[model samples]
Target: MEEYFSAVRKMEQTVMFPSLLQGVSLGDLANTLDSSSNEKDLYESYTLLKSIKTMVEDGLVPLNQTFPVATQMKEQEIKEEEDLESLFYYHVSSLYRILTRLTRRAKAVTSKYDEIMGQMNQNEKRLSF
Candidate 1:
């Protein structure tokens, strides 16, 4: 289980996230702030974060069943079990924090988009002379 958590953490930090954010330039964000393009980017980002959360949870399901087995192990094995438990919890907490932040960012993006659309509608009404 420790190995599995370690492998997932490594992939998330070193490969998955970096690849996902690779081409997202600051110019893209600035220019498309309230446009469909920005919404598309935010949706993709949210989806990727959701996928990562699911992967971590799926990996943890099997580990959840090993707690009873850990209690029955010998001294050295018991210590290893404790270590694995801590590692697993640490990954879970980290992923939770990341997901929370991602959720907040998505909300902010949506709000900004709505605000821009509202302003555009008001402008259009005033210009309908």
Candidate 2:
């Protein structure tokens, strides 16, 4: 049961979550007038998501590092009242969840990388023994 749960979490972090994150184009979301509201929401959501990804990749801090605040400020504006800040407050709970998942993924990836390296080193030692 424990092994099964670990495998499921690994799959969630590495395979499923990344697939959801990839191939998003903010530019296309920015364009398109008629559907601006929906697109804008998507853009904001993805922008926050990508920023979190960048922080993880850049190693600014380790996984599970607490973000400074809920919402990051961008130059462009969305709706007057329904801007990113407002949306973030409204969705603060979900944001926490997303951040937690991302942090888990970041840590999992690092752990997997370290494990592979350790295995390689062990094999090298065995071969040289």
Candidate 3:
């Protein structure tokens, strides 16, 4: 169980944080777009957006699925009469909360990506002429 939590924390730090950072950067780039913005900047933003999309699809989504399973397994392992059960429950609950927040963050980032892509499409059309 300890190992499970450790693995989840590692995923959160290594996978989620970098993805979130990329999302933020992408959002910033999107917000800075204007008539003067060039294709190079748009390309870089699109590349970063693709990378983030892949990470969320291939990495974070799987990690998110594991959290609920981990919580369930931890709950199963708990003994009603055990003194340390509360601590275990606390950890499980914490995992659930983290999972919830992570999912929400991912959804927000996905929406931002969609919005940016729409803006980029418009920019591309403007540039084509």
Candidate 4:
């Protein structure tokens, strides 16, 4: 889990941030005349990824026992106690999956930006990433 978080931080620090700073456009996915809600610009994606990382860094996970979801939980689920280890595994697995996906997305966006910039050295282009 820590490794996955670290990878996301690295992506933000090394790839996405630099690409964004360079103004490598992602084709204005948001301002299109008939833009669909499903289309997210790379900058928006980067901000989301950064916000998630910030939340994780700030230890903002809701560990409260009486959280809102507690009321919505099924009676059977309320009565049934989940094993801590299993819950940890579930969350860790979920985190791993999401971090992996975000990292891949960051990489793809960087590649697209590099293409837009028409960079010559493939190795140099991806060196920081």
Error of 1 at 32 (Å): 16
After superposition, the stretches of candidate 3 with alpha carbons farther than 4 Å from their true spots are 1-82
Lowest-sum lDDT 10-residue window in model 3: 14-23
Residue lDDT tens for model 4, 1-129: 565466565665556334453343445422321233232466565566677778777875565645576556645454554665776686689778777766655555545555544664666769868
Among residues 3 or more apart in sequence or in different chains, the pairs in candidate 1 whose N, CA or C atoms overlap within 3 Å are none
Model 2, 24-117: lDDT tens digits are 4334323222232333332244344446555545765643664555223322224445566876775677756555554443344434434545
Model 1 C-alpha lDDT per residue in residues 1-129, reported as the tens digit of each score: 344344334434433333344344324455433342343454455445447557666665454466664557545554667588786786689767655544544444344444555776799999996
lDDT of 2 at 91: 65
Full-model lDDT for every candidate: 0.51, 0.45, 0.48, 0.56
Local distance difference test, candidate 2:
0.45
Candidate 2 lDDT score at position 116 = 49
RMSD of model 2 against the true structure: 14.0
In model 2, the runs with Cα more than 4 Å from the true position are 1-52, 55-88
lDDT of 3 at 107: 39
- For all predicted structures, in order, the TM-scores are 0.41, 0.36, 0.38, 0.52
RMSD of every prediction: 13.0, 14.0, 13.4, 8.2
lDDT tens readout by residue for model 3, 24-120: 4433545333334333432343344345445644655554466667777766656543666787687789867644543433433445555655776
